[model samples]
Structure formats: C-alpha cells, structure tokens
Target chain A: MELTGAEIVCESLLKEGADVVFGLPGGAVLPLYGALSVYPAIRHILVRHEQAAAMAADGYSRATGKVGVCIATSGPGATNMVTGIAAAQMDSVAVVAITGQVPRPAIGSDAFQETDVTGVTLPITKHNMLVMDVKDVAQAIHDAFHIARTGRPGPVLVDIPRDVLLGDKTEFVWPSEPKLPGYKIPTVAPEAQVAAAADLINQAERPIIMSGHGVLISHAYGLMTDLAEKAQIPVITTLLGISAIPSSHELNLGMSGMHGMAYANLAIDEADLIIGLGMRFDDRVTGRISAFAPNAKFIHVDIDASEVDKNIKATVGMVGDLKAVLGQLLPKVEANVHIDWLQHINELKAQHPSHLVRESDELLPQYVLQRLTEVTQGRGIVVTGVGMHQMWAAQHCRFTEPNTFITSGGLGTMGFEVPAALGAQVGRPDVTVWSIAGDGGFQMTMCDIATAVEAHADVKFAILNNNSLGLVHQLQELFFDKEYIASQYTANPDFVKIAEAYGIRGIRVTRKDQVLDAVQQAMETAGPVIVDFMVKEDEGLYPFIPSGQSVKEMLEEPTLKEIT
Target chain B: MVQSNHTEQHTLIALVEDKPGVLTRVASMFRRRGFNIASLAVGNSEQPGLSRMTFVVNGDDHTVSQVAKQLDKLIDVIEVSDITNKSTVTRELALIKVKTNQMTRGEIIQIVNLFRANIIDVGSESMVIEITGEEDKINALHNLLSSFGVIEMLRTGLVAMVRGQTNGLANGHSEQVNSSSNS
Candidate 1:
C-alpha cells in the first residue's frame, strides 16, 4: 500500500474511473510521467500546447459528463492553461487540472520553474488547493474531482510539489468520501414555490421556457420536453443550450440573443409568462435589461441561488436542481395550449425571416454550413470557435440531441474548435465530430493538428477561409466606418498545406460546385482531415442588434421592395 | 434585480474553516465581484477549528446578495448571514489620539466622560482614548474628539450577535426572507 505522491495521484485518478488524460510532460513532472508509465491502460493525449491540453479536457468533460483531467508542470506550463481554465469555468464544465509545483522547501524562494499557480488560478477556478504534505495527495485528488463534478460544475486545480512526488512516502488509502462539510447543494425547491410557479404557468396565455446549459448539465431534457409539450408552451434555447430540445420539435424556437433568431427574441418579448429554466439572463441574451421581455412575469429556476435575480428580477424564484424541480413541477403543471400565441409566433417568424447568404461564384460560409447539414444528416456533433462561423453553424446546422452542439458561449474563446473537437472525438469515438472554425481562429491553434494526427483522433476540420477576421471586420464596418485596423490579417498561411505537412489529408475548394465533394471527402477520410472553404470575406451576420441596443432596434437587410 | 435607494451598508457574518488561504479566497471573491469591503474583522469562533468573519459591504441589494451567495459557494465557508436587518447587538472598538492643550485638556476630559471612554495612553501633548460601543457611538466620539485636533485613530469593524437565542447563524437571509413573507 505504500506509494509515492506521484503513484497516489495516478491511483486516485484510476479510482475515480478516469481512463484518459490530456497533458504534456516537463522537468517538474518527470516523476509523474514515470508513474504514469505503470498504468498502460490509461490513455494520455500529448497536446502541442498546454492550452490545448486544458481545452481538450474541457471538451471531454462536456461530451461525456465525466470529470475531465489534464496535467502540466509549474511556471509557464501552468500559466499557459489559464485561458482554457477560464473558458471551462465560464462554461461551467467539470475539469480537474493537476499541475506540478516546486518542492515545499523552495516554494517561496522563486525557484526554477516555480509559480504560485494556485494563487494565479484562484479567481478562475471553482476551487483549488496546494498540497504540501505527501499524505494529502490522494485525498486532494479525491476532493478536487468531487468539487469539480459537483454543484455548478467548474474547473478545479491541485498543485503538488516536486519533493512530495519524489521524496515522501505514505500509504495510499482512498477516503470513503470527501470530508467537506461546507460543500452542499440543495436538491429540491420548496413545495409552495413550485406550486406558485405551476400556478403561473397554468394561468398564463403566452408563456415561453428559456433553457440554458443547465438543462444539458442536469440531463433533464426529457423532463424539459415533457413540461414544454405538456403545457403547450414554446421553448427558446440559449446559444449554449442549443440542443436542449430537438430543433425539429414544433415547440423549439431557435437560438436567442445577439446573433439569435429574430423570431425567438420577438416571442420572448411578447411572452406573458417567462419560465427561465437553468438559464441566466446574460446581457447577450437580454439586449437592454429594462426593455427585455417587457411584458413577461418571470419564474427563474436554477441550482445556483446567486443567479436568481442576478440579471432580471423574478416574480417567483425556485432554487434547486433543475431535474428535481422539473420532476416536482411536471405533475402540478396542467396540460394546456396557446393556439393563438403559437399562431402569433408563426407570424413573427414569417415576417422577420433571416437574410440568406447568396451564392454567386465564390463559396459562402452559410452555403458550406448548409451543405454540412445535408452531409451529416443532423447526426454529427458540431464544435465551433467564436465568430461568424459559430453563428453560421448555429444558424445552419441541425442539432437534434443534447450536448451535440458544443461551443464556448460565456467566454467566447477563440481557437476552441480544434482541441475541443479532438477531445469530443476521443470521448465519443462512435460519433462524428466536426470543428467549424473561421480562418483567424483556425490559425490560433492550428499547431494542434499534429496532436490530432498523433492520437489518430477522427475529427474533421472545416475552416471557413475568409482571409480576414470576419466578425471583427464586420464590427468595424458597422461602428468604425470600415477602418480595419488590427482586425484584418494581411498574410495568411495555406491551411491545406499546413495540414498536409502534419500527415493529415487536406483539400481546398473555391468554386460552388466543389463544396459538397470536398466536405464528403473529409468525412470519408480515415484520420483527421481539413477542408478549407475559400469563403467570401464580406458576408456579415445579418439581423444584427448593436451593443447596448434594444431588440426592437435590430437592423435587417432590406429586400428588393424595401430597397426600391 | 431590485435597485436600492442608494448605496446601503450591509453587515455579513460568515463561519469558515480555519484553513490556510481561506481569507484570501473570501477577499478574492469580493474583489472579483467588484463589491468593495468597507471593513473586515476575523477571529476564532466559539466552535473548534472554525473562524468567524464579519465584513461591512456598501452596495445595492443585488451586489450585496451576490457577494453573500458567492461566499457561500466557497469550500471553506460553512455559512453566511447578512444581519444588517436583524435585531442584534453590534459593537466596534476604537482608539483615538487627541492633541490636548491647556485650554482643550479639560474640555476633552468632559467630552470623554460624556462618551464613557477611557484614557488608554498619555503622551506629553496627546492622550489616546479607547472606546467600545456601537458604530454610531464610535463615530460620534470620533467626531467630538476631532475638534481637539485628533492625530490618529484605529477601529475594529462591527461584530454582532442576535439579541436572543434565535440562531441567526443557522440559516442565511434567504430562509428568513422566505418565512417572513409567508407570515
């Protein structure tokens, strides 16, 4: 039973059923790497950069609903994971990050490869610990995983010193459970509160249920659908909440917010009763707080009480697990219908249809996404980096299952698609995973193409090669009078050639006829493949709501009649 | 989100595990949320291996409640109570140094007697008076001593307890608010 700190780390991870970890080795973590070699069944994907390691773990967690694990050395290796950790925290993904630290004796001396990573990551993580004693390694890892996977799941860090890994010896005994008295999450809402919410839902004529990531997190999609169908109410999903209910379902209105569907925003504004389930009223979703859903009486239900009334005031706030609350509410909610309200929503959708991206000779991003929809048959998991391509994917791709549409909505982190797709593919090897990224974001983490090739992760990359930062350029065109300063990249590398250099198949398509064939080729290829679609540079996301503006002030592309 | 009339002061008491880096976690939570802490006092509590912290916050109700819930989310924090609206006996101790002259010496003593303060230390031209009372009383004493040309002052923030055995530390403001609204 006697084991070194390094052995305890691996043993505890194995005990928690973590079979895969994404990491890179360094001088400070050599002991851990040695211990890792003993466990041949545990897979470790060697990432090109520490940031990709953290992001890959995040993607794995989101895909599998298990705590994703990543490892790094101290100093630069640990600091480089900050962006990815912050992304996981923002998205509320369960990730446990383990970093090597300097020996306890030399910790404050600013020794080589020494950094206060616990202090540095405190604000970004849900919880973090610096383990100084050797006996605490197993318990620390146990506690870290428990905290990461529990209430309002987020990233947690455990920094272990080198001396503890190398010098100290202790019996590795896994505690029965975490001895955390302060860690508790309420599971049930009060009966009266649930009754009040049900009463409001039963009485209202026009009601809409706004779903966020919590729906997916709690695995309450079935209950959510039951409630929506039982009540005959419409559901508008947030950007991250894309697949909470099937898009094909008659009740599901598309994405809501800045780049969301115009009809969805209109429905929310027109609703008389708004039941906010597991979704925060982010500023992006609610354009102007005072004017957002001006007519709605809100009922907010979330596990996190702090989120209740943090953005918009709720008439009745029910704080508990979404699944449990919905369970208690499903019976109390009477089966009803709003035929007039549904007809009105249909009218709104008919009136403000999104402007289609026209195809001339060059490839349009939307056209490619539409083609992807056709090719995947709404069966593939689509991951996206932030920008025009993300919005385009949200608009075009058909997500039918929960956790199928993965993207960084809260942090809006760029360069997320490549690593996230790889992690998702690794987590769910049976499914087809695609990374839809813009040219700028593709270049940011394109170095990870080598990582994909090494792991033989079957992930397809569709780079919307617009040769410009399309979203930022569009912002400049709208606000700065088209003075593109730092937004545009003058010289760009050939992405197809870059992927081919990493022993991955690559293809480039320019004309309209070459789009579907190229996409089909990437899908049928054996290993990782990249299809660089030479898209138009000036295609702006239309029906835009400018920052700090109300939903009523959205600008839409004029049709020929309006133009005349 | 109810907007307050103005920036109102709130007193929050929290019981946390006596663990290393616990204070930093609490302080960092407040800083990240952009809620300013006017005063903070930390010491061992009645329970073993636990510390009690009382901090004064000035912000709208939305931000203050946010801080309280976020503090509750920390692993080291066992419970948090916003006793600003509750019936409690709150006390703060302060030491004020007043520059005493021939004409103001008697006047300062009379004022100190009125305030029921003690002369803790006496220098050649200055006397340090120590006082312990509610926040308003301390503020009043400080205001009166300032007329005698005060040199320095230090205050321990407000620490409070419920007047009776109502167990204010057992549950947070949310539970109390829920019960009060029902009645």
Candidate 2:
C-alpha cells in the first residue's frame, strides 16, 4: 500500500505491538506529530523535556519487559535524549528511540535542526540506522524493535530525515521477517557448559545464587527461585535484580553489593561456589577484583557472551537466555542443605544486622520507605531516583514479585524516578506506580509532573526531602572533612507548592506519624499525587564499601572516614 | 613504533554485511576499547552483498581473542576468525613516488627491476613505482626507495586467504570464548 514515511512508522510500531510512545515534538519532527494525530492506535505521551521522553520509554520497557518507544526532533532535542538512551544502554533495557533529522540533501550541510544522531548514539546503542530513503523507514523500525528485544537487549536508534517523513508517496513493503543476516542470537546454551554449572552447584558445600536484571528480562523469576530452593542455596541480587525473588523467602538474602544487606555481602565473600544468573559483575558490585569472592568458583550464565569474562573470571560460562539455562540446570542440581553455611550467614546477619529504623520523632528516609511498603501492602511498582532515598527503598522493599523495582542501576542518573514512574504507570495502568525520589533529584525533572497530569498516568510520587544531595553530602562528610561543595541546596523550593501549581494534589509531611496517612491518601486518590516527606537530614546509610574496596572493607556504620 | 599492552600480534578476518557507517562502527569499537589496529583492508567479498575485512591486530592472545569476540558480537559482522595460526597467503600493495632526476632515474629503474616492481608513471623530477607482495616486501621497497627522496606513498593494508581450499572465516564465531589469561 502507498504510504508516507510517517505513516509507515506508525504501521511498523503497530506490527511491533507498541501501543504507547513517550515523545516531544519540535521543528524537524512536525511531520511525525502530524501523522501521529491521525494514527489513533498508538497513545502518544507528550513529555515536557526530551530527556523525560527517552527515560519514560526506558521505564516503560523495564516495567513491562517490552520494547519501549520514544521519539524526538533532531539537534538539541535528540542530544537531550542521549542521557536517557545511555541509561537504557547501560542496563540493557529494550528501547527504540526515533529522531527526526534534516533532509537527505541537507544532512552533511548542517541545516536547521540537523544532527548526526546515529553517529552520536553509535557506541551507546545496540544498533542504529539513518534511513535516507522513505522506503527504508518501515524496515528500519522493524529491524530496530527486533534488535532491541533480542539477546542482551539494549536501546536502538532510527533516524529519519524530515524530508523523508514528508517524502512522496511510496509503496510500503513490510518484510516477512527482520532482514538481518549477520545478527546471530544464541538460543540453547551449550549443554556441556550447563552441565558444568550444574556439577559445580551439586558439589558445593557453600553456594549462593546472584541474580541480575537478566532474570527479569528472561522471566526466570520462578525458575531462579526454584533452582535456589531445590539446591537449598541462599540467593542475593544485584540492585536491579532486587525483585527476582520474594524478599521474605528463606533462601533470599536480598541485595548484595555496595549498599546491600550486610549478610549478603558477607555470604558472597565466604561462598565456595557462586552461580551468577543473567548478571554482569559490575565494579560497584565487585569492588577490587583481587579480593572479590576470591574463594568463590563462578558459573556465569548470561544471554551475552562478551559479559562472561569481561569482569570476574567464569569457571563455567553459559551464554543463553537465563530462563532456558535455569531450566536446563535445575534438573542436574542435587538437593542438599548447607546447614553450617546458612548458620554462619545468620551469625553475620546478626553481627551486621541490616540496620532498621530506631526510635526517632524526626521522619527518617528509611522509616518513610518502610511505611510506604506497609501502606501499599508491598504491591506498588516502586521506581526510584538515585541517592540515599533509592538505597532505602531497595533495602526496605518487600518485593513479592519481579519487575516491581525499577531504577537507574548502570548509569545511576539522579533525575530518573519522576519520568520513569510516569512511564511505568503508563506501561502498567492497572497497578499503582510510585516514584520514590530524593528531593535533590526530584527538582531536576519535576517539569514532567505536567506530563503525568496530562497523560492521566496514575503515579504516586513520594519525595524524600533532605534539602540536599544526601548521598553526595554523606560522601563529603566521610571523605572531605565535612567541607561540602555543590552538594547542599542553600534554598530548596517547596515541592508541594510546585505540585499544586501543576494542578495535582500535594501533601507535605514532616513527622513520622503522617507518613502512612499520606501514602494511603496518594495511593487512594491517584491521578497523580505528590507527597513530600521532610526526612531527617543527617540520617546515615550503612553497608557501604568505599570505591574500589573489597567486601571485606564494607562498613557496618558510617564511622569509617578518609582524610582526602 | 606501534605500542600495545600485549606484545604479540594476531591476524583476524571478518565477513560483514555491507552497510553504511559500518566501517565507522568497527573502527569506533577499536577506538573505545583502546585497541590499536596494525593494519586493515576492506573490500567486496566473493559472497554477494557482503564485505570481507582483514585486520592485523597487535595484542596478546587473550586480547586478540576478545577483539575477535567483540567483532562477532557486532550485528553487521557475520563471522570473525583468528587466521594468525592458520596457513594463509597474505598480500599488500603499495605505490611509491620518488624524486628522480635523469641521473637517478636509471638507478631507480634498476632497483625497481631487482624487486620485480613496475614503474607505473614517470615525470620530469619523479617516478611512481608499483609493488605488490607481503607487507615486509612492500616495506623493504619503500625503505630502499626513500633514500632517493620519496615524495609520496600509499599502501593497501594486509589482505589474506587460507593457502589451500579452506575458507579463512570458519563461521565458528559462537564457539569461541574469551580466553583471558586471568579468566
């Protein structure tokens, strides 16, 4: 059928099962917006800033495990989306970002709203294409979705010139399948490697399973827990892998890394065998390579082969979908209980007990998160911004299910929660989405509160207001002799007032007694509600390993300091 | 002199689907990883709609293996083979223009004849000589011609194929694991 390049884009999105698109329109993307008006199948969320558009798309993908779509104009608009794109790339979220470029003839000439977006996004994206021809647009979109959702998922960009979007009528040819001859996705992992991993698990007296975000992407939550339970092994998770198993499970040791539960870090250090599923051992997770799990024999299972030995060595590396690998491995593993190991871990847990909220009249961030969990019945899909607030939310979450905990783990972008919550709310409309953010980060992307209102995205934003970049302030307090710089906010704005101006219900709570009530009100009322909790400014976070230090260097309290 | 973290050099052959900016993609991967390519040559392959690239990568065995693994991971690159250990015939072509007066012209011709090189073009003060062989032969010719006041030189980097009927790219990209010494 004859179609304009813009129409072909919509058609391709329809084919790819993409129903929501977070986007912002500008000069170059006018044709796309014009086409979008007529295409009612796709619901377009108009965000205030292009960064939110990309981030929201990333959030949507993380929440629903589908390829999220975002669109923007070229030049400044496209450049602004780079951070969000990088966030997705780092975490391996599947996002298809579309940007408008100048006309084909004006591409190299630096015309109005012109940008070499593909070039800029090349290294960050799983793949990218700049379609010079109108006929190539549909295929490009199809290929993008295919590439983004495949093994080791990541963001992909498709740049279409403005003239091409407004190109003359051309016959739209939808390919039967993605025309990628070179793209080879690994299916079933090598049987020998799977057997090898199983052999390690069966024989180990002290073993732990470290689950990563790949578990969620592969929908291996139940299988992962099954393997753990059958082997009677304790499971610890990467930050993004927080919800892979129910927090209350006997074998679930919770988040294990910097800012992880003390017992989990101790277990990783002492374990004889580590079966790593769908996770790369990032620097933050593995402090000092020389000292990280020195006694642990690693069996690394992931979808991407390159990540196997990129960090810590893998005695057995299985490159396949996590769920499939788990299915293959579950049968070979022998059922055994490491009673002594579990008892030793319990001793560590008692010694460094994951610090709980103490008696305080002042509203603590950890207390705020605990109340949120209690009030929401632990069902709220919590999207967190970076800082002390994020760690509290992660530590306090009663994750009964996977895909409920979404945050910027890889890039650690501060202003992530607000837009990401809107995206998550959009992705899963039936559930209540909570954007639990620290005040310092909340202000950076608060403009998107308008987008949340307009889109009717029902997200509850709980602002943990400490009047400063609490994490940075804590770092400065520990390392720089309390000589703070650029971290503390001299005059922070009234977040509730900002919310009220945007025509959303705003509640301010500074006392511990008011947290549950505010959380309840936000969850119940719900088009979009903002609750700014004035938390205790000096509340210390524990179980922190200084940068590049090993798990052995983990500090149980904030007493450790460096003169530098 | 080319500096590398690893002393050994490896030759790798990659078969990639011809696409725009694909060369940039491959080059960008090397640049970002801090890998130095000693030599590279790309041209259309025997297979239609595909391009064959021969790369002389300078690194240790593990680093070169990683380089090959990373290349195979690229969506455009279909296959990558470490042809360093294989029995292969390599060729490189170089064109040299040297300053030559009437007195030095015959001497230049004599030297070119000794190397079985052709004098492709002759001008009043310069002559362009064409030589095709392995990299060492071309380098030797260029060094010898440099004493006659070489004006310009261009070299097509290394290209190779297995000596017999075997294909250089074995399509065993997936089976190859990163052989890091530490790992």
TM-score of chain B of each: 0.88, 0.89
Per-residue C-alpha lDDT of model 2 across residues A1-564, encoded as one tens digit per residue: 899999999888998999999999998888988999999999999999999999999999999999999999999999999999999999999999999988888889988778789999999899999988898888899889989998889999999888899988688888667777677777678888888888888889999999999999999999999998887899999999998898788888888888988788888888999888999999888888778888999999988878877787789988888888888888988888889999888877766667455556788888888888987777869999888999988888777878999999999999999999999999999899999999888988999999999999999888998888999998999889999899878798888888889998999998988888898898889599999998898887787888889887888764323222
Off by over 4 Å in 2: A558-564, B1-6, B99-111, B123-125, B145-149, B172-183
Kindly list the per-residue Cα lDDT of model 1 for residues A379-454, writing each as its tens digit.
8799999999999898778877799998988899999999999888899898889999999999989889889889
Best by DockQ: 1
Tell me the docking grade of candidate 2.
acceptable
The TM-scores, chain A only, for the candidates as listed are 0.98, 0.98
Per-residue error for A521 in candidate 2, Å, reads: 2.0
Residue A222 in candidate 2, Cα distance off native in Å: 1.5
For candidate 1, the C-alpha RMSD (Å) to the true structure equals: 3.5
Judge candidate 1 at residue A179 and give its lDDT: 62
In candidate 2, position A164 carries an lDDT of: 93
